[model samples]
Target: MRHSDVLVVGAGMAGLMAAVTAAKSGASVSVLSEGAGVISIGSGAVDFLGYVNGKKITDNPFNHLSELGEMHPYNIIGAENIKNAFASLVEISNANGYEIKMNEEGLNHTAISIAGTTKPTYICSESNNASRILKAKKILFAGVEYLKDSQPALAVKQAKQYKIFADAEINSALLKSPFGKTHRVLNCLDLARYVDKEEGFNWLKSELSKAAAGYDAVIIPPICGTINYTKHFKELQNLGFILVEAVSIPPGVGGYRLRHALINEAKKLNVKFIENCNVQRAVIENGKCKSVIALHNNIAGALETEYTADNFIIATGGIIGNGIASTPDKVYETIFNITIDSPVSVEERSDKNVFGSHLFARFGVKVNSKLQALDSKGSPLYDNVFFAGNTIAGYDFPTEKSGYGVACSTGYTAALSALASK
Candidate 1:
């Protein structure tokens, strides 16, 4: 049996944030996850409502919160809490030596995407800013020998189409893969790990130093060091070259770095992480959650373990994350077996266009302003059970580009509410 003041059932952005926030509030926190969350597969930049009604948002995203539905996670968390949450995230990232910069005017800043398009994002790493990339007098787009996914030419083409770096001379160069002759094919994660080491850093420095002399900034694949990217970024800049990481493909190295940094900060605050543990069910007693049972498989067989906590948070994510399971007839929350707050019929959810709005996108447990899970009658289900992130109803993450912002804000609010509960 394991005991904690707060038990977070997912290790994604929301869960990790909740753990850190609760721990900072002087609670003993433990996080359990079956695998790494969507952060690793996401763009490292934090997007806060890039598009509203098919229109691009260039100003402060918070100003458009009123446009969101009443049940949207941001509305539930409120603007003040969302602002504080971003402040906390910035503080944490800065303390870890990675400076996440936002516009002083509080507007969304443009960032270069993997496809070379300019996308709006709220908070971005200092090295990944499109505004900085545009300011360079001359730009060099460098590609690794065997890493074929990132196309320098396409990136340049897209940048020209978007009028980004229009004033700068853009050049492309193909450099030796960091893996050398040992590995014919290089994965982005492997490249990131290699760059994170001292030997690999020296090799990269040697290679880039050869081609980086004339250019004001070097645009390369997001292969900066996995865990030590800030150090690498600073050291590379000290070599008289501004480093810019191109938007990454799936399993993005930048996203992995962000996730790693957050987890590292959480660990520093004594948040316990239990990996590969699939929480199966919650033990509820008299309208309160007392414990959760998790199952793990080893060489021998399946082992079940119980974790008891004064408060529990379900930040398990949406359908894509397997937080909620769906069928032809109904949808259900994976652990608690709660009926999802969605239209009951499948016929009503069917959409002809694949890219059109998905009925499942809006499927999640309903919650009140306190972040407490609510029943059909809008009554609290469990006094100690709270929900955050994609687990809560409302908001379309993909179309709105509000995933990270909602997760961060709601995660912070959930922690604060749980802490205030008796």
Candidate 2:
């Protein structure tokens, strides 16, 4: 049996945020994770609201929060609370030396996606946000030669298509491979880990210096060190080079940088982490959760582990994160037996376009403003249980680009709410 004041049931952005927030309040916190949450492959950008009414958010993402349905997480927690939560997260990250920058002028910043296209994000890391690319007279788009995940030409072409880069001079280059000939495939994550080492740092510095002699800023894949990324990013800036890292696809190195910073901060406060923990069910009684049961692999078959906590926070992530499992007929929360009926078939639930709105994306355990999980009647199901992140769904995070923003806000509020109950 394991015990803590708060038991967070996911290790993704929401779960980590909840755990860290609770721990900062001087509560015993333990995070049970089946896998490293979506942050494992997410861009470091903390996307808030990017689009509403099928249009780009020109300034404040919150200015359009009212446009979304009331059930949306933003409405539940309110914009002021969300801003406070986001501020808390920035303070935590800055203390850990990982800075999450927001638009100083209350405008949204455009981050370069792995596809070389621009996406509106409310807050992003220094590397992901273009450092005045639109104002630069000369820009360089470069990629690691041996890394197959990115291409300089493709990125340059896609970037130029945007109206912001219309008049700027953009050049493409594939830097020589430092890895040398190897039968193994190298990716952005691999390069990021390599950059964490001293030798790799020397190689990257030398290569960038040669390639960025006459360029104002250089756009490249996410290859900053997995640890101390700010230190590395700052060092590169000292070389008179403004480095903007394009967001990458899965095996996201940028996300790993954020994850490392977050987890490292949590560990300093003594937050325990249970890796590869698959929670099976919740033990609820008298409208309060006492403990959760998980199935663990053993030498024979499987083992059941009971973890008890004063408060339980469900930040399992959405359908993709496995917080909610879906079948052909229904979508259900993995724990607590909360189910949402999906009468439509796979084809019916899907949109005609790949990037269109998804019915399954919005399927999650409903929660109130306090982040407490609710019954179908819109009543709190448990006094001590709360939902955060995609687990309490309303708006489409991927489409809105509000993933981390909502996760951090809700997760922070949930932790505070739980402590208040105590």
Q: Which sections of candidate 1 miss by over 4 Å?
A: 181-185, 341-356
Q: Which 10 consecutive residues of model 2 have the lowest summed lDDT? A: 295-304
Give Cα-based local distance difference scores for all models: 0.83, 0.85
Cα lDDT tens digits for candidate 1, 146-259:
786777777778777655566888878877876665445566677778988998888788888998989888888777787788888888888787887777777577777778
* Clash pairs for candidate 2: none
**Tens digits of per-residue lDDT for model 2 on 46-139?**
8888888578888677789889989899899998888888787777777877777778987788888766888887777888888457688788
All candidates' TM-scores?
A: 0.93, 0.97
Q: Poorest 10 consecutive residues of model 1 by lDDT?
A: 178-187
The candidate scoring highest on lDDT is 2
